[model samples]
Target: SDGQMPQTREHLLLARQVGVQHIVVFVNKVDTIDDPEMLELVEMEMRELLSTYGFDGDNVPVVMGSALCALEGREEEIGVKAIDKLLAAVDEYIPTPQRDLEKPFLMGVEDVFSISGRGTVVTGRVERGNLKKGDEVEIVGLNKTPLKTTVTGIEMFKKELDQAMAGDNCGILLRGIKRDDIKRGMVIAKTGTISAHTKFLASMYILTKEEGGRHSGFGEHYRPQLFIRTGDVTVVLTF
Candidate 1:
């Protein structure tokens, strides 16, 4: 209960496996630690742990503060300085999205909805480049064969836009595509931009029984239901 939680490490590994390169570590309840040396020690340990996981530990910013104090609506408790520090760190360490207009269009469908007159609409943030009306897009990662469709319309913030670039949330209308053809987590890219893969590569770190919080260890060939976005799939393990 005192050291780093096992689940936290697992989550970081999962994030990296899924293409998350940068991370911000927020150390909460700093006011509870009275000794300065103890706080320093905590920081040192966190750096060591993060370094082991291929993260930039030395230059990485760690913001220590207490949310409970800030929630009290008074500056007397630990003050607002800690919160300010955290926000400053976020602005400094977090890199802005690189939106390249020349790059191919890519968007991960966050949600799919059925409209009365719109036929089908998929809402998501443009991951890169831009998505425009009448642009041919290929859907991948849901199944073997990719479905190709054209963007009929793009709407951002309730206003119809000719196109949406990376980092903008927009609902896109598809031509002749139904709500059933699209789902969350499926990536839509420009035609000839994405290729299907049979196997996924991962640098995974498995958990022990105690860390996994299971009564018994998972045996070989064990199958587990994997949850991704708004769907679940049962997968079998080998070796």
Candidate 2:
């Protein structure tokens, strides 16, 4: 297997940041390696890296294989057989994410429009929970003060609806809030469920030149656009 690279490390950081609890590592290109000990070393290094990122490194599944060989249907030791083992490991290790409607309602604002006689309407896919007409919600994020508003109406495909839930792309009309007050990066959620986070600590991964990333290095003052949900806000990085 090819040894871990900078991009792999970056990916690990992102996965850990996004609350990935389990990892099934497929150590590809094992056919290129002539030494068995090298493969063992790679696995050991991978486990250590996983542990460093708050994963169950010692027990994380690691499968060695050559994807090219598997596609060509050659070398069963590092081909189809290994792929089968990898698939088995993945099926056994990764857990399905629960998409329950019982969760709090949250929708990221993607577009905002002002209705002539009604009020400001924000359109986006409902991320979780359910929202009904007259339900109070909070508009958060976009580096602005949080606004409390009532869901005066919900519409999907230009048809008025009494309620909307997770996975539905709908427009929500708010009471009292002007279209200028809401932006694309803002979020509307069940009141008091979430707050706008102006500052927080995070593990950041800067890509290397070999990964076709930044050729130059940045420092603590680097301000990069941090994208969360549908929002992208410029954030200052502290070393």
Tell me each candidate's TM-score: 0.70, 0.59
Model 2 score (lDDT): 0.87
Model 2, range 53-152, lDDT digits (tens) per residue?
7889989999989999999999988999999999999899888656659999999999999989998899999989999999999998864567999998
lDDT of 1: 0.79
Q: Candidate 1, 233: how far from true, in Å? A: 2.8
- Candidate 2: count the clashes: 0
lDDT of 1 by residue, 39-157 (tens): 88888999988888788999889877778778875653454777887788888888986777788988888899988977888888887898878999998876778898998999988
Residue 161 alpha-carbon offset, candidate 2, angstroms: 2.0
